[model samples]
Target: MTAYKSREEVPLNEKWNLEDIYPNLQSWEEDFKKVGNMIDDVKKFDGAIHGANDLYSYLSLGEELGMVYKKLYVYAMLQVDLDTRVTASQALLDRASQLGQKLSAATAFFNPFLLSLEEKTLQSWIEEVQGLKYFEDDLYELYRYKAHVLSKEKEEVLSQMGEAFSAPRNTFGMINNADIKFGDVTNKDGEKVELTRGMYSKLIEDDNRDTRIEAYKAYYKPYVQLQNTIASTLSAAIKNNVLMAKMRNYPTALEKSLFGDMVPKEVYDNLIKATKENIEPMHRYMKLRKDILQLDELRAYDIAVPLVKDVKQEISFDDAYDTMLKSLAPLGEEYVSTLRSFKEKRYFDVRETPGKRSGAYNLGLYGVHPFILLNHQDDLDSLFTLTHECGHGMHSYLSSKHQPQISAGYSIFVAEVASTVNEILLIRYLLKETEDKHMKKHLLNHFIDSFKGTMFTQVMFSEFEKITHEKSEQGEPLNAEVFNTIYEQLFRVFNGDELVFDDEVKFGWSRIPHFYRPFYVYKYATGYASAIHIADKLLEGDSDTLERYLTFLKSGSSDYPLELLKATGVDLTTPEPIQNALSIFSELVNEFAEL
Candidate 1:
């Protein structure tokens, strides 16, 4: 009963205007050309930062140019994402990517300049120049990586080559979202339904198992046919990781990944170890699913359904936003007031449309406000999603207001904390407010499922990614047969004996776009862990915890992400965060059992 077309057919209202970024493409283009011209100007001060005065001027100029580049990049990117079909938008994206490379190349001297200065000299510069006070922590963080930073030329080469280096990921995304087709599925009413990715999700989450299975199979059929292409993309991505690690003189890809966040190797290893030890919870859940559904066996398609059914409820977008405000009130009045503006201002693109990118994310940039992309539907799930993204928006709002623009962008390691914390708070808020047993059970299922997806499943993915890279390091060729065997083994490992591993499920990796992102999924697990810990602290209603949490949000990239997290009481470098998160998972499972 729904009519659909590409997003351009129903463009967003001006209410979601990005004119704050730039007035128009012409102005953006003008700024882009100005950036190209400023390349030479930046090169002049490269090797001449000798005295404190020179360093101050260099730092201030660098910050100003950085603000310019930030505005240009966010504008072009927002335009491209809004209507990806326009060739002009695609061209702008290409230009913006290239310009970003140029900007990085130009700014390469900042790190080396600081690295060259003795600690006392750097301190002298901070004291002598008031402008540099805001960025003292930023410079200190960069200096922490002085041992890892390569020669300026090598870093510049890496920066310029990054776009080409990330092509495999881009190709996989293009194929999966735009090119591949999932035919159609027969619905409960005997009507044939087209199996677009959006529709596929709706069908899989349906209360009917038959609809879930058929939709899952039909949806993945195209990926099965394109296995070779998918394998090639995976191979290229893995190879890129190995190549980059070697070039950077790191022992392995994992070291390079951990180094960026100042996370020790033990952090990654501990998550894998902790998940392996406690994986039975996931397996037990699978067994519970089989018993609940009265099935002889389960398959990959069965992974998404509720253990207790007939619990679905419809929630509208307006109601969802209102509920988010109610749930977030525990954080105090200022946080609640800012969240209200984001909701009323159309700060989010809240509905799914044809040709729109899938999933949700909060994009932050200097000077411009944070933007969130969401494929929202008016359900309890979507309401939780709204609360989640608003958490991110609010975090970005605070950081931008409290920190220098250069340090306002948070590291990915801690990025998920605010968003997931919002979800936790909302779940607790709803559970406290509702009296109906079904709604209570429904909310509990939602919380349990969040842990299952964000913590457990992503860790499984992190393991898969680690194993894939290790095999690639050992010179094993990543092809259809080899990759399928590995994928099947992981399925068995994660699903235990309860769920049968169907051969069709091997092609599932091809459908995932995140694998192309180097070691990114693990952050989702770490983020949730940090969020839950922070949420518990905030719920205590202690001023110190509240102030510390806010300070952590505003800390941004002022320090290594783990060090910043330590200030907030979550030590990602240790096993405790993962263990704590998993303990909550176990408790949720037991609670669900009692309910």
Candidate 2:
């Protein structure tokens, strides 16, 4: 085994080329100060809007300021995201966020002013202003939420108080995930492994049961010790959601979140119901794991081991690039050509090194092409991550090319669909092309692992979130004991009679950052289910389906997510998509067992 080299050891030119965003930090600082000065100019928008014409001028000036602000903020955020520990980058991020808040407060009148328009008058003005054409849909969306729009002064207060109001959640993020300390664990070979959160996650996925158990216990002891404070932090965060919902006059915070995406409540409920009903496949798969590993019993820690380890395959970064291009061919030559450009342009930061972001993501800007951030280690997981993030990059590339800047950015509801679609397509391609039986079996197992994690497990977490939110709404104190109880039950439902849900796993909710965003985890389950349906269409070589899916990708915020998805022949409002995914999971489970 080799000790991985830290990023400092890697040549700077081969690393993240921040030169693409800015030539150097000094230039970035100059732009940062320019953006700071521009914020003062945005203050002019506060008193400019008195009517539709006034609103048009105000909006034009605001958009220009916003474009520059976006450029500055994106650079800062991308730099921070690449490695969050950089002190100067972190300071820039804070300043950018503060500037954003100030600008948002200044522009708060635009919506209320638009709401003041008579329906016919607003409609006429909408047609009259050529500058408003690209924003027609967003303006209409604002109109749709007119009833919920607070008075300008109240809205401005909310905007100004934004950073202060969310302090507890931010506090939790700092201490829990970033700076927490946990005990070290001894690996199978008797070497001490210092267990950071990232290392703990990778360790628990190890094939050795003892290594996983040791990692889990050592990693969580610190969280379990401070469970009360963690509970209070999360409780404060949840209460803030409830408070904001009440202030906005929404029925609930869940309603507030779903409305932003124009997602129906049924979409959430159906995901919960479909996943609960279909959890047997996951349970059966877990049982299979226990038997295959020849363990007396299965533990939560053993969930990530390969079912057949002797069939090993490793992919390098270059091989991954070529393989991804081939796997994406079903999306058409135009799509493949853009991916080729992404490769040639060195648009990806593809390697694992200290202090870099742990997971992988693709970030894109309006005027710029997408860039992917990864901690790649040439494993199956990293390969999947490359394709997944590429899905996002390609989606961004197409959307930016097709839609205007404002509408070019998409809602989070449909965000995961394209990525998962690529993952499914990639798996299908691998299985079809491989001649090795063991490798094929491993591929099938890999796909099953994806279904298990993204669909079944995420839906379970979503249910837990709903339960906790409902409990909090009833004024129940979300102490560790209560939180643990709810988590234990959900785990039992997903894990079934096969394994025990130790009390420690109850504190697991505290470890999941996604829970901080109310009702967010459900998207992963919905994304997985929806992607399967779209992948099936594309796999059958249906050009029309490809066209519709591409249209959905380019739609951005123009249409409701359900409407956009329906154009691709999948209605997330119904349970069909989730059920379809469950059926496919069943098929894959059976196929893997046979293999």
Candidate 3:
């Protein structure tokens, strides 16, 4: 394997075109000042939004100001992620954050005031002001939460407390990413390699079982040591969620978290149910791994190692791009052409450089093209990661083009659907093209592993979150012991008796960062299920399904996520999507067994 490249050494074309956002710092500073000036202008219409003319003006100004805010904020954030060690870039990011808080405080009264208006009067204003029709859905979305909208003074207090509430998550990050040391472990090649969150994935996937076990133990040791502190931080975070939910009149923290994204509790519950019902397939997969690897007993660390060795292929970045475009051809020529344009335009930062952020994501700014950050490793996984981020880019492109700035962003509930759909398509294309039995088994392993990771593991985490929050609400002490016991039980339930776990597995909850964001992981499960169903339809050559899926992408936040998905023929509110996805998982497991 090649060593990672520095940012300066990477080819210019491989990096993202930050100039597309702004030519230089001076240009960004100009927009920064312009947005700062507009915050004051936005506040002028605070009390005047009651009238039809003022309402129209306020909406238009708010949209334009929002577009500028997104551009400034995204530019700074993308810059900072490129090299977080740069003080100037960090300062720019901080300035953007402060500006966001200022704008939020300045316009905090808009929602309360709008909700205060009688429905009849608001409707009359919408009819009288022709431009207000453009903001009809935006207004109605706010109105939907009228019952939850607090008084202006109270809302301001809550808004100001935002930074304080973020302490637990920040503390968790500092400990996990900066403080905790995993130490070094010797690999099977007799070389000492440092254990890290990023390295853990690669190590666990190694063909050598002893190497995986060593890395897993080393990687989780710090988490076990800091279990109490991590548990305390998580408890505080959960309490914050519960307090906020009560303040907003929500019955439960889960309900409060889901309500904001317009997701029903039934969706969360259904995912858990479907996962439980499908454990037999998971057990079968586990047995197959044990059989193929010729292990006496299957351990958690043994699960991720490839079943077929020497089948790993290194794919160049250019080949990955071509494969992605071909895999996504079901979306039509226009979609493929636009994706090709993104590649040519250098919309992606495609190399892992010193100080660059880990993982991959697509950052979508309102007034600029979506920017993708990737630490490309030139493997099948990297290829899939490229496709996933591009899915997000395409989604953002379509939404921004079709909707107003005010409604261009989609909910997190449906955000993962487009990305996971691309992965499914790419996997199908590879499976069809590969003729080697070992290669086919490797691809099948990838598919099963993805299902287990996204669907099974996330749902397991979601269940753990639900139980812990419920216990905390019931006044149970949320110390390390309490958390470990709950986590161990859930692990047993999910993994069944076929698999064995080390003691360190109990502290696994302490390592997961998503616990800070209550009830968020379930969306990964729901999104995967939705993506599977949609990908299956499109792959079956349903032209109308592709059209509907594209429309779903462009719909953005104009409708509730459930409604948007329903329009795309996937009703997440029901259990059918989850069951269908699991059925596909079962079929894939059988295929892998035969291979």
TM-score of each: 0.93, 0.95, 0.96
lDDT (Cα, 0-100) at 208 in candidate 3? 79
Lowest-sum lDDT 10-residue window in model 1: 7-16
Model 3's alpha-carbon lDDT is 0.87
Distance from true position, residue 401, model 2, in Å? 1.1
Report the C-alpha lDDT of model 1 over 52-155, residue by residue, as the tens digit. 77777777777777778778877777666665566787788888888878887787766766787799888987898787777677678777677777887777
Which is the better candidate, 1 or 2, if ranked by TM-score? 2
Which clashing pairs does model 2 show? none
Where is model 2 more than 4 Å wrong at Cα? Answer: 1-5, 11-14, 187-189
Ranking by TM-score: 3, 2, 1
Candidate 2 local lDDT, 1-595, one digit each (tens) = 1235566665453466667777887886787778667666666766565555766776676677877788778888877776667898889889888888887887776677778778788778778877766667767778888778898888889998889777877888777646777877886678886776556656877777778888888888888988888888888888888888889888888888898888888889988988888888888888888888888877777777788777645777778878988998999898888888887777787765655666778887778678788777676777899999998988888889988777788867888998999999999999999998988988998999988889888988888878878887888888888888888888888887878565577777878778778888888889889999999899999999999988888777677778888899998877888898899999998988888
How good is model 1 by TM-score?
0.93
| Best prediction by lDDT | 3
Q: What TM-score quantifies how close candidate 3 is to the native fold? A: 0.96
